[model samples]
Target chain A: MVQRLDYLKESPSQTAGPYVHIGTNPNWVEITGVWKDDLGLVLVGPETVGERILVEGRIIDGSGALVRDALVEIWQADAAGLHNSPTETRGTADPAFAGWARQPVSDADGLFRFETIRPGRVPFSGGGLQAPHVTVWIVARGINLGLHTRLYFGDEAEANSVDPLLNRIPDPVRRATLVAPRTERDGMPVFTFDIRLQGDGETVFLDM
Target chain B: MSGAYFQRDRDWHPPALTPGYKTSVLRAPRQALLSMPTTPSEETGPVFGHDVLGPLDNDLIRNFAKDGGEAIGQRIVVYGRVLDENARPVAGALVEFWQANAGGRYRHKKESYLAAIDPNFGGCGRAITDAEGRYAFRTVKPGAYPWPNGVNDWRPAHIHFSVFGHAFAQRLITQMYFEGDPMIWQCPIVKTIPDPAAIERLVAALDRHETIPMDSLAYKFDIVLRGRRSTLFENRMEGN
Candidate 1:
């Protein structure tokens, strides 16, 4: 066995830019039939475990202007708290769930929406349970690198209060940025998660 | 182990002011939250394959003549290699690009119709990298256009490029400018890149040797992704 291992140095990052969507989601631009739909259009099917939910929000910049061209993607575990990954060693995850979704902000209102099931609590490698949450990745014009953050359910206050990662945040006020408040829009349950790219109420962007 | 150091650019990008230039509003804010340690979730990203690829008939110059029509402007070839920080080629990477027409007009609904549209030019192209991490595109030389950054402000002639490496986390998007374009020095968007080296990397050099001789002029721009500079994250110990 080798005593030491070497790794590749990470390359510097750059913004996703003015024409990202045209390249990534051609169908959305009226270029049709690339692959029926994008890869992350569905997070779960009828046979998947968990309550189906809709995640909606907008990407706001530092000046409080909506980022009309921003793209958002989410990844999470199934309702049983197991990831749909080939590397998952704990046990087999739900086969019906893909656990990922991607959407671009709408042109009219700059809002982005995803259809997925609410994720369940997952185990922390150390010793505790993490609150149920979904990881979100955001990219847009003027954004040098894709921003990383988490969206926790507002209704899951009990579990969130003691989440391993949540507890690491030094300020309670900043922690609030991660929670998606529950609301009703057009008679359907929606978790509103507005991402602030900068300024007064900047969303908590993770280092990774 | 060398300590992991991820220094946020103090000058590059938005939120940082560029002297004598406007147009940096709505950029991301600088905060402590962005500097916090990233978990495993942030480090790992999804893998992309043929599924996300565009149609095989995506070459812009060729498509420009699909209707037996011609795209207006100077024909040019832009080519490059996508490499990691280690200078190793990143094979099979996806490279996508979009730009304005020779008249500096985008073929989009939101764009103002002030500039004449080149019906033959779709203004978009994409290609997969070969084993050598090389990709190329054939298109017209885009024209400079006006923007709302400031009164009489104009964007330099540029083509936006997006590259997706093997992993999701390594995706990158940036604009490429023609070498020695005077507008680059004055454009706030180009000026926002803090580092001189980084700013220089955005420019594609004129490749006289690779020019199509009688057909088209060639330009080269090489992109380098982050190398093996993984952060030295400490192992989590219970009850630490």
Candidate 2:
């Protein structure tokens, strides 16, 4: 039996290297020629519509080690419940906000921070509104595939209770993993979201 | 289960699922909860235009090579087309990659490998697919290095790839291993694909025609994004 060699086979999967930062966020790695700044760093300008908020948290691996090299990206709807995307036919998202961000877990403590507005409630496919939440994607050296999750605002308790996706999680404890605790720091609303990759308090990582 | 294709086998990936694999702390079990709907928010966009591109984005080798200072190792050209599962070209996809240096050490602070740092290579690059879905990069061959996975376990020579197609749902991230690397079979990462046919698809062969006479060698690696499989998530609203 002979094998065909016309198109090269796609390579096997490997974890993103420790230096994914250099590629994804070149400016952070000090690769100056790439761009003035990395993409998704400033998702919202001053004119962006939304209740601006500070989202911060650490990514803890199962062994309790901080995934220092982890990179986190988030996507969400603007305050008007509109998405900043070309596919959005319902309404235009705030022109000032891209509604997306890519943040690296800080080397000091594996904490990732994003400065953006609190996302507005968006609709589910069939009907009804989802909770005000941010879709998150996480990648690091040990993670073969990027992990997907969501962070709902703790203050949006009513919306959280009715969120279609949150209701999908069968277990209450697991559902709790999706909510971000809210607080006020420096006179601004802050949402603390800690993502646990594995173990007792493992975050609810969505398969998509 | 006829005609149903699960992307990964539990045994092959996240090695901890296999009894006694030893990296239990990092492994997350494949649960029914993972299967969910992908909403419009999950998508990257209608297209990834030049807005996301960086100045030195396309050429990975020269970005880190520092003014034509040749990085130490074998120089090779990696070129390929980004296509849909149906075999159509996917133009305007953002293709990005990073890898270890010739000595198998990354430019990361946490990397403690004793190998000498290639003052010339930063190991990162990004290129947008052309109208024909073609992309290319010039880089040094990466070396194999031991990891904490197990005793004597060394990663195979490979390049990490991240592609953002027309939409977020079309995004893919995978590694391209060198053809004929003996470590392909031994590495747990490669075995994770489960299907023998799928695993074979990952190895890129050397193209003598692509090789530059007295200058460098070339390798061809084409990446196929989802077409019909993407429909599976259309109603579901989540998960890539």
Q: Each candidate's iRMS in angstroms?
A: 4.3, 4.9
Q: Candidate 1, A131: how far from true, in Å?
A: 3.4
* Best model per lDDT: 2
By summed lDDT, the worst window of 10 consecutive residues in model 1 chain A runs over: A4-13
Candidate 1 wrongly placed segments (more than 4 Å) = A1-20, A30-40, A46-50, A61-65, A77-100, A120-130, A141-146, A183-189, B1-23, B51-57, B64-70, B229-240
Q: Write the per-residue lDDT of candidate 2 for residues A1-208, one digit (tens) a residue.
A: 7995343332334556577787788678775664566777877787887788999999887677777888888888888877777667677778888877888888887888999998777877556788888888787766766677889999999998888888888788888988999899989999999988777778887754
Best by TM-score: 2
Real contacts recovered, all predictions: 0.31, 0.35
Which regions in candidate 2 have their CA more than 4 angstroms from the true location?
A1-13, A30-35, B1-24, B27-32, B44-47, B51-55, B228-240
Consecutive 10-residue window with the lowest summed lDDT within model 1 chain B: B1-10
Residue-level lDDT of model 1, residues B1-240, one tens digit each, is 222223334344333333334433456546765444333333333434545554533457656345567678898989989987557797877787888889998776667839998877767777778889998878899999987666777889988877766443455677889998999888767766766666777889999999988899999988866444443586757574
- In candidate 2 the C-alpha lDDT for residue B47 amounts to 43
The structural similarity of chain B in model 2 to the true chain B, as TM-score, is: 0.81
Backbone clashes (count) for model 1 = 15
- What DockQ does candidate 1 score? 0.34
Overall lDDT per candidate, in order of appearance: 0.71, 0.73
Score residue B156 of candidate 2 by CA lDDT.
Answer: 91
